[model samples]
Target: MIFGKKRFPGAVADFEKAVRAQDGDAAQEAFARLHRAAAKAGDGELREAGPRLATLLPSVPHGPRAAVAVVIGACVERGADVSACAPGILAGARETFALAADFCARWADTGGGELPDPDDELTEEIIERAGYEPAVGWFTLPQWEMASVAVLNDPAVRRESAGTAELLALVERVAEASDHEFRCLAYALRVLDDEPLVVLHRDTGTGYALRMSGIGDNFQLHTLLAGVLIGGKHLPGQAPSPQEIAVCRDAPGQVETVGSFNLVGPDGTWIFNEGTPTDIPVIDGARLLVLDPPPYRRAWPAGRFFPGMRGDLVLDRVLDAAETAAWFAKVQPAKR
Candidate 1:
């Protein structure tokens, strides 16, 4: 009967009532409606509603807790201050739904307090013990999703089929010219393609491609790619020489060098000591060539990279030339 009625406050009240009564069905319906209402609400309204909904978390039924957490996550995405909700969110995390807990933890404000190192490990163990399914659809999370769709749509990110063919031919020629089968790890940042990719080559003819969309920055991307090459058994017949291991082990912690490498284009333009592979411009047919020792020693912490988690790296598949070209062609890059 009321004209221009505000939906957020009313929705919040209904949600709180459902939680208080521990009515799972009603809570679910209420949360869905609340989520829709939240989408329409202004930032100021969301900021006000966030703390109110957080207070109801302790009373929320276990069955509906994850749904509530999702709502809270949306609130945080819209500039809501829900720092007061950390204790309740962490509590629910300890109780159940570890996957959802991990998602919610990103939004929780810790007041500049670091989690005790041992307790942090114990919590990770508990989450592992929960046996949650692997997280997928990483692009759904705001943080994981590319900040600028315009960047992803840029034409420079797309490589022409002719360029890809040339790159394959170049790899073949290099392999034929070399003594050992060509093998190395390479990374490509095609922002228009949505995810940055790391290709691990056991041999020149074939390679495994992993989507590293979850990597936070270029530095993390370099570090993780290096870690995977070193720690993993990607090099089949070739074992790292003792000198190679010693060099990696003795390298200074903050050294910027990612070993000796050449950055080349399919057209034969080459540069040396320019920077890490990641620093290369996003041009069609550009490549980073690491022709030195095979990576077979651990140079970074193992636990830093989370496989199959949201906003973390996930293995895509093994790809040869044609398959790789097909994958690249699937997404149409934005034209200039």
Candidate 2:
């Protein structure tokens, strides 16, 4: 039941007024000002909550203040009415909807749905109706609450899709990586193997080409389409354009994508002109894995301009420091 109020007055109030009203420039400015208040005492909750809620609202449904306050309380101590807040969390952030739905539905608690049998086509029907189908009716039914139920209950997704060649081999290798309960694009990380992979798809004037980086750690090239990246951008916050979104669809019957890369060795390097397989060194050792697509054949280079996005730069930064790797690999691993 928390309400958002104008904490700042005077000219600040007037500016905030414009911002909340959806005045683009003012909204951006207001966001900055509000962001500063995020860390202050009694403000930390709202501060953290605002950004997350911004993503959820208009897509899910709920208030930001109430949601953040509940999360804050949950983080500090127990006995919080999380079930009450679960809907708010889901209502606000789509990225968290799966988890949030699990929470509000009280999946793990006593009197919870626990899980339904796989033959439960009822759950499948719910998913079909609610999951990415071109309408919003599913979110309104009991289905949204049970969405994650079908997700974890279905043994099919966990068993892994098999029986292809090159890409399939690469995907199976992903099994070697860390395991987290995967879902939707989050599962993409398992194949792509990391947090979100950032790609650059700029208009290279030759139509448009794409390239991603994760080289030395992953000895494979992630050739992708501009549409894939752009598609993810349409999720309510940003409209991923050809420049922002790049396609990484799987090739055939296999669910593996072209941009998928699994760590095979340390010599991961980009090969320019596949005509001869030239080595493009992993940017910053292995911190950068580059994905370069074939040239777009339009407007001279007028098809797709391949803009290379900085893939997991963290690994490159890590690989750059031999000492850091040694410390963790030797010093830490022995203790564990």
Which candidate achieves the best lDDT against the true structure?
1
Best by TM-score: 1
lDDT (tens digit, per residue) of candidate 2 on 264-293: 112333333221111322323222223333
What is residue 251's positional error in candidate 1, in angstroms? 32
**RMSD vs true structure, all candidates:** 20.9, 18.9
Model 2, which residues run further than 4 Å from truth?
1-91, 94-105, 111-113, 116-182, 187-336
Candidate 1 ranges with C-alpha deviation above 4 Å: 1-5, 23-26, 97-336
Per-model TM-score on C-alpha atoms: 0.33, 0.22
Candidate 1 on 65-164: residue-level lDDT in tens?
5556556645655555535443444344333323323323332332223322211222443334322221211112221111111111222322321232
Clashes of 1: 3
lDDT of each: 0.40, 0.28
TM-score of 1: 0.33
> How many clashes in each candidate?
3, 40
